[model samples]
Target: MMPSATRTDARESGVIGLGFATLWRGIREQPRLFALAASGACLYTLTGVASSIVLGEATERIVLPAVRDGHADWPAVAVAAAVIVGVGALRALGMFVRRLAGGTVVFRVQGHYRHRVTRQYLRLPLSWHQRHSTGTLLSNANADVEAAWNPLMPLPFAVGALIMLVTALALLFATDPVLALIGLVVFPTFGWVNLWYGRRVWPLYAGVQRLRGEVSAVAHESFDGALVVKALGREEEETDRFRVHAEELRDAMIRAGRLRGLFDPLMESLPNLGILLVLIVGAVRIRSGAIDVGQLVRVAYLFTLLAFPLRAFGWVFGDLPRAVVGYQRVEAVLTAPSEEPQGTRNLTGPGPAALRLAAVSYAYPDASPDGTAALPGTAAPAGTASPDGASQDDAAGPSARSERPVLSEVSVEVAPGSIVAITGRTGAGKSTLAGMLARLVDPTDGAVLLDGVDLRDLAPGEVSRAVALVPQQAFLFDDTVRANITLGLDVSTEAVWAALRSAQADRFVAALPAGLDTHVGERGTSLSGGQRQRVCLARALVRAPRLLVLDDATASVDPRVEGAILAGLRENAGASTVVVVAQRRSTIALADEVVHLDAGRVIGCGRHVDLLASSPRYAALLTAYEQAARAAGTDAMPDPDLATEAVS
Candidate 1:
């Protein structure tokens, strides 16, 4: 378990730091975009204010002359035409820059978010990933990042609008203070309404996003299990469940739409009401000769232009709550506390130190829905700490000390170059033990030591170089056979084929049409279960790590394929520690010694013949494996003595 004090501090600091760092990267990387947007906003506001002033002056100069003295000025008319053309040209440039800059910023921010999320995923622990759905992570990386840019898109236009409105109001105040003050009164009310609506919409949008994730998950699961769903004839049931989530999402959208429908019309009316009041008072002033007719015309036009932006300002604020909520949701994932805090550590090379587990234990996380208790350190079935070092209480939180004994007071040492096979029943913590060896999870009580140094003391890269675990469910990317085989190593084409040959995967791969270039499809769905496992096995072998961990890696392959792969591995064996979690009597027969586990405890350890004679649990486990293999259509059972003698 991670230390409570350290993990808490790091989690808090990391989330804030990562968020700000990403924000800084956006600004630094897009300086030109920022400049374009700022320049565009400046030009837009300047054009609006200049147009209003020029129009007002032109009207007073020409219309008043014609009305009072029966004379028209051609020069004033020409000047007004020039102002109109200049303002139109500036507004066009403003629109071009705003669109271009907004797009550039959104793209850059999305790229940054995708890269950071990928890095975070690689660094987070296996247990952390186990608890989260892949769909939610995908949504955070793709959808949430895109939505976060909503507020940013309207910023330049909003700023330009505000500047134009302020200038227009100042000009109006110069002519008539009473009308200007009345026009501004509606703004406070608009701000209050915006605040109220923004608060109400945030939670709804968050709920919608959550429902969207669920819908995606359901769709993904349905597609992945289409065969099972069809075979079970539950298509209608599945469809109904999907519809429930979809309808929930639709209803949320409708509610949000209704809110906007009410707000938008109200927003439109606010400015129009202000316009009516401004025009009425201005006409009175004009009649009293307190303001000129030209000035009154200018104020009215400017107020109308202000209407577009004021309404835009409301929208910008309206979208802000949703955008902020999206940002926070993404931040929660990107900034989550890691199971292991990463540092700058590099795995150097193959070292001669052996692996030693000294009094280690572990427990399942409290948040797991399955209530699967961990190894040594969890409360015993009797609800008390066992003398062997199992915990007496339940594990607490993310940073809690493990209470279940996933492994307790258990100490083992693997001599360099030896093969140690762990034999156990289905729930005997064999996989958990293998995980500990690979540093996938830290122990609760003692520590796993490499050579004389604690495993944690070695750099992570070094630890990775030392150990590798090929899990039961072997996974591959949607790529070619060569890519999957060479995934773990920085190797040439020759090296890749060599590893494949050693893992006995070279024959089938060579038979494919594209050979090394054959695309594997998603998770190697194009390949059989056994072929996928071989490819994963080849991946581990390619790296040539000092310690090779096989957690039932051969369980999926045919007995013939398994035998051939094991033969190849044994021929090349040297000083590497090979730990196999076995369910096959044939697989166990290859071990230098077999360790038997029962209820998370190692009850017996010895050579196969010795265990068969001395340990009933080991005999029972072997009998079960043989029975399972027979049921699966394999006619042969492994001869314990013959198989043991062959590998040894």
Candidate 2:
């Protein structure tokens, strides 16, 4: 959770600072373009005022005089006509340039912010990602960014309105101070109406934006779980859930619309009222000989000219609040602190890398109120907080006094070129230890080292090159099998084939119509569970990592295939260290040594036979593994005593 002061600052700054920050960024991104756009807007405003002045002069000095004198002032008429045409053409040009430049600025700003948000997403840790949904993040990058910049689209027009208002007011006062005084009432009244509308509509618009994200999240979950919904005949339930959010969004929009509906009439009517007031004052002034009829006509025209620009004033103020809210939402994601400090040391000369965990302990971050801290593959009801009043995804702060450590004060070491099996019962920290050795999550208490250097001290890329972790669940992109295996690596086809052969995946892959070129559907949905696991194994093998950690990576495969894969790895054991987290006796039989874990503590370490002889917990866990393998109808289940004696 963010500190109360920080959150309050965000909300307070959101009212104005966020909008200006966006404007500043736009200016910084394209200073020359923004300047040109502002210039064009000013020119457009000037032209509009010039048109009003031309009309006033034509009515006063030329048309009225021509009628009274019974002869046309052809020169004056011609000059007025030329002026009108020139100003109109220039106004059109100004509109074009303003739009072109303003649009360039808006789009460039949108794109830059989108790129920054995505980069931030990538830089954030997986734990951070778990707290946010895919739908919410997507909305942040797209809809929120669009809403934040909505004011920019009308910004130039609003600027023009300001300039036109100033110029027209100056001209009006010059014609008749009394009429100008009446006309000025419209400016403040127009502002008041907008202020009223803004205060009403801003909260509604904020609700609408939040509901939009909720609606998107629900829809995304439905689509991603479409198969489950259909299979379980829960389509109607999903539809009802979607309908609830949609209705909320609809109601919010309608409320905002009603407020705008009331405000629009007032905004439009105030300027017309000012025009009437100005005309009445002008009529009185003319009769008293305080101003000429021509001057009175000019005053009328200026007041009338204000009508259009005043409407633009309403638009700017009305949209301003919503844009501010949107910008604040986007800023939250961009400003989140990254998970861990980066390292500067690089790995060198890594052959069969050594690995160690020194007094390591880990605990999941305190859960968020919304259950965001739940482990991957576990589902918690929305809006539910843990007993400790923390979200499932919340990281325990450095100053937190107590922790529920997943691996408590446990230490282990693997020599170069050794195959070590880590065995544990469910929730016994097998997977957690694998994650630490692979550097997926840092320990809460101690350090992980590779080749005598703390893993935290190694550069990010160094860790990637030195270790590969193939998790239980395999994820492949929607690309060719070859592409998924190589993943932009500059590996040759031969190396790819060799890796596939080592994982026992080449035979199945070769049978496909395009062989390595065959495209796998998203998440490898087109492949069988075992095939997907094998492909994932191949992906890791192609990297030829110095340290390979497999967390039940072959669980979906048959025992025969698992045995073959293990044998292949053992044949090349000198090239890399292997750490296998297993619950299968067949897999355990291949390890040079075994570390038995129970309830987050390492109970024993030795060859399988020695552990069985020494540790009762180790014996019980191995016996359970054998019984489960037999129940699953595995082709080969180890003979109980024979397995113990073979290691001996």
Candidate 3:
């Protein structure tokens, strides 16, 4: 379980510090852009004060004399109008620069961090990713990064507002001491009101931001599993689930809005109230001749000009906490530990890389020591069907899996150019072990080696060039078949044809409307399940990996087609070692050797026939598989987790 609101509050005290620290980091990294923005903001804000001063001068020199003489002073009025226009022109120029520079600052920082987050996502180990929701990660890279930088657009303007306030205060004092005192009283109250408002809105803002990620996560999950949701008649349930999150997000934003509803009124009134006070007091001072109407006008106008700046400050005060929360979230990914340190060691001469798993043990990070996991709401590993209520996928948000080790200390070996099959019941950890052979994951207790080089020690990209794992579930991008198979590789058309032939996909692909150019649609939705699986195979085969791990990659294909594919793999194994996670008896029989597992341990390792003859447990398992196969009438596409229906 995660921490509660009360606990998060302990960190809330540092929210302001976090926001400024991020601001400082951005300034240091992109100094020129921010400086330009600040210069522009100062120019405009100061010109605002200058405009007030010019108005006072115009009133005293032109208006008062004209009124006294009952005639307009045309030349003086023209000069004053020109001066005001010049100041206005300067303000416009400043506005242009500030807007241009401030926009760059916001986008550049957001782009920089978004790239960092994405690269971090690619570089982080699969295990690290499993701990987070895809939606949350998306939110971090997109929405959170955007939120963290939203205040930047207003930040420079706010800072200039500060300078403007100070300059205006000095001018007010220079103009009239009594009027200046009112500003002194009113501005501090503005800060105090903002401070109070910020404290109230901070948590609400954080909640709103967090809920955005929740909404994103739920939406992504629903969309990604649309088929399952619709097939199971779960559309209404999914909608309800989404509505729950959307409503929560709406409620949170409303809460923040309600706080601002009060805060904005108070902030606006302070400046206007100052203007009123100055007017009432100035009327008396005018009668006594202590201060003139022009001086009072400048003071009241200064108060009026200050209204927007006060609101700007209030905006920063209100927004900084949310920015802090978002930055904290984005930084979590940016600073996450990268893939385990690389090693300088390289693989020795490699043809078909020999595989070795020496007492390899793996426990899902939060699994019980004995290899049982008990997480309640884990997402199943992607290639599988429904979650089956498996807690192991919690390895994604991982504590979602149930208690039990996925793999215990299991040892296995595969010679070069050989076909080995990993067989087990549903939870027998077949896919987990195959993943180790290909270095998809590291073993907790032992090591996986390729051509006698510890996979971890081999230089990066070396293993990938030599190994490929095609899991039971096939995934395809929304692209042409050629693009999907080559995946941007510059492979010769001949080599691609040969791979397609091996996977039994060339004929179907050749008949498509545009042949290899036909768009597959997202996740290969345009193709049948078997065709998708075969296309995935062609993708891996085209690479000609030295070792290929198929975690039941042919499950959906016809048994006859699967047999031909197996024959092709056997021939291909002459140059590339093949590891198949299998449930089909025919698939197992074709293997040169089979490793049988129960629970998380390898219980048998030998030829399929030998295992059935020697180990009753293996015999019973296969017999049950055969019975399930007969029942399904699908040529022994056995359910790895089916109850043993055959009496031994």
Candidate 4:
């Protein structure tokens, strides 16, 4: 849902400017089609004008003269009828052309805007995505785009209405100026009624659009969390919540309908009233001998013709405000600043991948200066210099003051082809560190280096190619096992098997009914937690990234399976550097070095034994890990207090 302030701004930003700009862009996109449609509209209007003129001429020349002379001019009457028939046929053809071209324009415009919005979603950063819900974004691409272009559907009719009204009024005045003067009152009245209607309806329509987004959001949440809702027996609560939003949407739509209903009747009646007024005035003028019966009849026919154009004019004005609001919403997404800035440099030379964090620190936008909790791993101890010997104060200046740092003034380096383990309590910023290593996000302060080049300096694609990060939650598309593992890579089946084997996932996959061809359900729901983790691990392994950062990726796997996976990684350690965010001692035992974090600050970094001897915090943390593991019936450490006793 759009913020109230944003919606207010959209409403205030003159609909004509945005609406015309949107129309102009659509025209520019398909100039030939738009031009053809406009020409058809012109042709259709002129044909209608011609038909009316032919009717007036037929009445004046043949019908009226024959009636006065008391003798039927059959030949002249037949010629006039034939001329009317010909004009009617031309008008029908013009209508056909106008409708065909107008429909094509509507489709093209809707498609063009939808495509642009979808592309913008892809280009936007994860941070931006975090701020908006999936349902709102979907509505922006689909419903909003549809609403924005809806005015185009009746565009040809509206354009022709303007032409018809102007031409018809000019002819009416020429035939009987006194009747034309009274008929013209309808135009100003129609304008005033619509102007009043638009103001009243704009807010209601905007509210309806907003409520639509809210309804979509609620539905999406309910569906996505179906399992949780059912398991927790919260279905009634969820249903009630959805019902509230639906009722609000219903109320908004009904209110908008009522306003439209009132306006439509007024618009329809006003034209009929004009026709009546014209008849009364035309009769008076006819008695005064200022105009003939044929002229009076023609002027009345022209007023009757105003009905179609006037209603179309009302439709155009009535729908314009909603279209403008929808377009502004779409434009907001298209014009938002890209979160991922392009980098100019490339990562060329490399052995495995040398990783470095130089004074790297990050903070959430709302974090407090006094160091309330921030995004895990972004805060640093106050006044501490980075591991690479850079000061945090120098690296992050005034801009950093507003942010609550998640990782603070911390730096660490891992040599090529080495395994380093990161361990911290929940919210210790373990995952944030892994994210920075993979360049999923940039540090608010300092830099992350790959092969001695700042990660930000390398193109995003280059960084992606060099680093593979398997987050704590393993997500898989609903695709075949082989496709999930390969993920569009041009790797051989043998390579795939090797990667699966390394992640300890091959045996189960081979046993499946279709082997590698078996489909994994959304997020791999058909698989057990361990199976899903292994599949995700295989996905990363198959890429053969120079640097692999695993954020507790193997937590669900059996200890024996995790050990095998770690051994496999160790065997290939010479070709790649491995960074594991681990809590299990079995996993940490395999790492050549250990980095322990406390409250987003790196308190110690060394080999496990070295840390146990020198850092009391490391030993205490290890004891906590052992106790938790024992409680969970998985004791990777046989001696829980050994490290603590050694330190003492």
Candidate 5:
């Protein structure tokens, strides 16, 4: 959601100057193209005015003479008709250039800003993402960008309308003083009516744009949680939730439409009145011998031609409110503070990177400045627990819900090539600690180091090359298995197979119809849960990272397959430092040493057997986990998040 202060400011900033200024900025950004479009618009306007003049000349010189003399002036009529056709051809050419160049300007500006927004998305910290929903971000990058540039399509037309209005006014005055007076009144009235319409419609348009995002958000929420909704029989509830946002959007659009309808006629009638008044006064002027039939026809025709040109301003202003809101929304993303600055230095090592956490204390970026907890998705990470033994998509929750560092000041070290288990009940900050190992997030206070060098000091891509963090939720792109594993890396087929073997995913992959070439579909939906987890593991393994942080990465895999992967990793122990967020007793037993965390502090560290005998909380949590597994009548590990919630 946008901040109330920002939205209020937008509502207060009326559409007149702001809309014009916004349109000017876009034109300025793509000057060359807008110049072409403007040039075309000017040509179109000039030719249109010329056509009216030519027609009036035909009436005065050829038609009137033929009627008066009772003879046909075929030669002169041919000449007049040729001139009109020539003017129209030029007008058509101008319209073509205006449309083509104007379209180019819009797409280029939109594409430029869309790239900027998405790049900013990647550069921002996870904490920032938490504050915004996926739907809102999508709206910002896609819908908002397009909306921000919507006015550009009509901008050149508006620019040319100004020229047309000025030229028409001058030509009318030159034609007859009485007719010029009508132009003066009609044009300003058109502007005034549009101005009135803009002021009243801005807030409504802004409301419609804002609710567009909300509707998208609700629809995304329903779609993303479809399985849960269906299982819980909450389809009607989700539909109602979506309908509320949809109805708000519908109401806002209707209000805007109604407002436009009420004012359109007034704007439309001003030009009609100009023509009507011209005809009325024009007859009087002709009878008085002050103006001839040619001049009267010219003045009235100019007014008729200018009806649309005057309303061109109306077109631009009509789109202005939505454009302003969208531009402001996009600006918010572009100007948002970025993540921790990267360093120029790179880590150099062939062996595993040693690990260190020096009094690490991490508070989410969106947490209160005073260190007070925020809502579930902001101050705390987002994840949930399933009633089943395993989490369907669980990561961590707002367990402790503290604005203070989830992982309080405490220090630990891990030797290179050693496997260490970071165990805690739920929200004891185990996942937070695991994230530190991979620098997915930086600490609020203190530091995490690798090989005696602070992680922050390493240049961008250095940390990624040296470390790989595999979360419980396995993400796979829609591509071949080989493509997912290599991920554009120039790894050979042999190496891919090697990583697959190590991850214990070789057998199933080889059994596929196309082997490594088999398409995984989106998020690997074609594969079973365990197969996806193993493939993700293979992806990490292929990198040959020096540090591997598995944050409950094996939750979906069976115990046998998990053991095989752990065993294979053990065989290659000296190549990478392994940090596992452990829950199962078997996993804890294999670690070189166990780091038992309780309430964000390391309560015990040593062999798992030693911790069981010493730390009561550790023993109770594991005891609860094992008993729950037994009660479920399966070897599946109970969700650590659920266990921790119970213990805490």
Candidate 6:
């Protein structure tokens, strides 16, 4: 569904130059579509020209004779009627072919563009995804692509108008060059008018498109947060906000509509001015015997037919500027560089996965406007700047002067078949560390290794298979529970059930009316928070990943359910390497080893009890977690043996 050639940007070459080039490219991409449309246009022009010629002859030969002789030749009359009918049938056939061709072209173009956009989304880096909204992406994929066809629909008809104009001028010149010249004068005037209209209209169209994206995004957000809004009783406020946006959109569209309404009537009338001038001059010519009555009648009829074509021509001129803007927007998404590059190869061996991060560091692109600082807490040191005065990592302020590093030149290791829990305060870069392991973003320096191979060396799919992530917010597709659990895998029902059991989701899933076949709804809205978390856990377990990373994935589940899930994981997935970024002390205490993180540095790494004894930071974190749990009364301490066995 992609057009091969894009519309040209007219700013550089002037409107006509760029518009024609862009059109030529679009036609070139789908030659068959263009050919079919062009062929139909040719037939349409031929039908008009033929009708004019036959009707003109009919006026002179038969009508005049009938008025004088009082009887008509029956056979000649039948022949003329039959020929007109035949020409009309051919014109109808041309229309049918063009309709089919135009539809196919438009459908294919939309499909191709959507596919390209989806592929781009998949290839882009995690950082890029962080900056875009679901609604903006949705509009580009659905609405804008469809709107693109409006400008294209009238293109073939305009071609037909051009052919008609040429043929009419030729006929007019033969009858009288002066009249021909008068008709030709409209062409340049039409060009100038279109130029003026295009300049004023394109910017307005772009503004409308931008506003449409924003409005769509807002609507999507509001819909997603409907429950929250209702809970807070903010519906009236939300309604007022939406009304403001709706009013803005209405105003923009009205401005565009006003321009169209003004220009369209004027364009239609301009052609009639040519007709009037031609007729005035023709009247003199006819009296001087320079042209006949039949020729004058034909010329007037031709101009009458031209009135409709002129309106279509005006539409084309009115929309070209907007179409170009739309094209450029779509092209920008298509042409943007992928936030992450594709790796060349994949890990070959199959065994327990081991993860190692060696001297890793990262920085944001815009943390410092002067290009000399790092993001807050991400700087290496005050004097630790590159030769260009930029920090190794980004800092928030004017220089590489942040007090702490986001991620220092630190090293860590997770052995095969181990469970390592990571604990940190809210903004301590724990999520960043997990992201590096998942290869969502590559390290700024050093490397992450899976079973002795650098992550960058592994193919994306291979890495996906090797590592599975369960983020804090788990997403479920709108499908049956079974489908969401297995995703794209071809695992048997028994295997799916086994994974669900292991993730402690089977109990609730079995209680549902449809069991595994129950619908999850959009993002699993039908499910409770705990149910959704369990389902996500089942999804990750179904993959049987060598490395499983959970970034506070069970935060919403009740303590008993969370503990049950952890126990199930230990029992069912004994040899898998597990990494958990946790806020709850019980979960961290259950892991074989605990890594205490603060200000993006690993302050302690050892068995939880050992770290509590050896590292004051570890003790403080555990104390804080316990105090919070006590304050919230989430749950009393479970069997102490549960924590001991998790560490054992």
Among these predicted structures, which one has the highest lDDT? Answer: 5
Candidate 3 vs 4: which has more lDDT: 3
Output the lDDT of residue 315, model 3: 72
Write down the lDDT of every candidate, Cα atoms only. Answer: 0.70, 0.77, 0.79, 0.77, 0.81, 0.71
What does candidate 2's lDDT look like per residue over 443-531, in tens digits?
88889989888988987678878898887778899999999999999999999999999999999999988999999888888899899
Q: Which should have the higher lDDT, number 5 or number 6? A: 5
Instruction: Quote model 1's TM-score.
Output: 0.85
The model with the greater lDDT, 4 or 6, is: 4
What number of clashing residue pairs does each candidate have, in the order they appear?
16, 8, 19, 12, 3, 14
Kindly list the per-residue Cα lDDT of model 6 for residues 342-461, writing each as its tens digit: 677776656559889888876544334422211111112222222211212222333322444456765789888788898776556677677677887777788889988888887768
Alpha-carbon TM-score of each model against the true structure: 0.85, 0.87, 0.91, 0.86, 0.92, 0.88
Output the lDDT of residue 254, model 1: 88
- Tell me the TM-score of model 6: 0.88
* Candidate 5, pairs of clashing residues: 372-403, 373-403, 426-644
Q: What does the lDDT read for residue 43 in candidate 6?
A: 78
Off by over 4 Å in 5: 1-14, 365-400, 640-648
Q: Tell me the spans in candidate 6 whose CA falls farther than 4 Å from its real position.
A: 1-10, 367-405, 572-575, 636-648
The stretch of ten residues in a row with the least summed lDDT in candidate 1 is: 375-384
The count of residue-pair clashes in candidate 1 stands at 16
What is candidate 1's lDDT per residue for 1-648, written digit by digit as tens? 212442354356543232334344455657778667756876777677777777778778877777888777778777778878988898888878877886677677678777887788787776665555555666667777766655556666777777777787788788778878976798788877876776676557656666666577577667767989999999999899889978988998888888888888888998899889878888898889898878887877777777887876776776765565456656666777876644444544463347677877766645433322221011112121221121122112333324455566667777877788887654567777887788777776788877656767676576787777888778899989988887645799887888788777888899998999999999899999888999899888888878898988887888878988877666666736788887677887878878887666778887888999998657766775566546556744453333333333
Model 3 segments more than 4 A misplaced: 1-14, 338-341, 367-403, 641-643, 646-648
**What lDDT tens digits, residue by residue, belong to model 5 across residues 1-648?**
335665566557666777777777788889999999999999998888999899889999998999999997899988998999999999999899999999999999999999999999888766566656666777788888888898899889888888888888889888887789888877777777777887888777767776776677678778878879999999999889888878988988999999988877776788899889999999999999999999888888888888887777777877787787788778878888766678888787698989988999875433344222121111111232311112233233343344345678869889999999988766577777776777767877898998888888888888889999887778899999999999999999999999999999999999999999999998898999889989998999899999998988898899988998898888889988999988888888889989988777888889889989988878887887887777778888776657556555
| Greater-TM-score candidate between 4 and 6 | 6
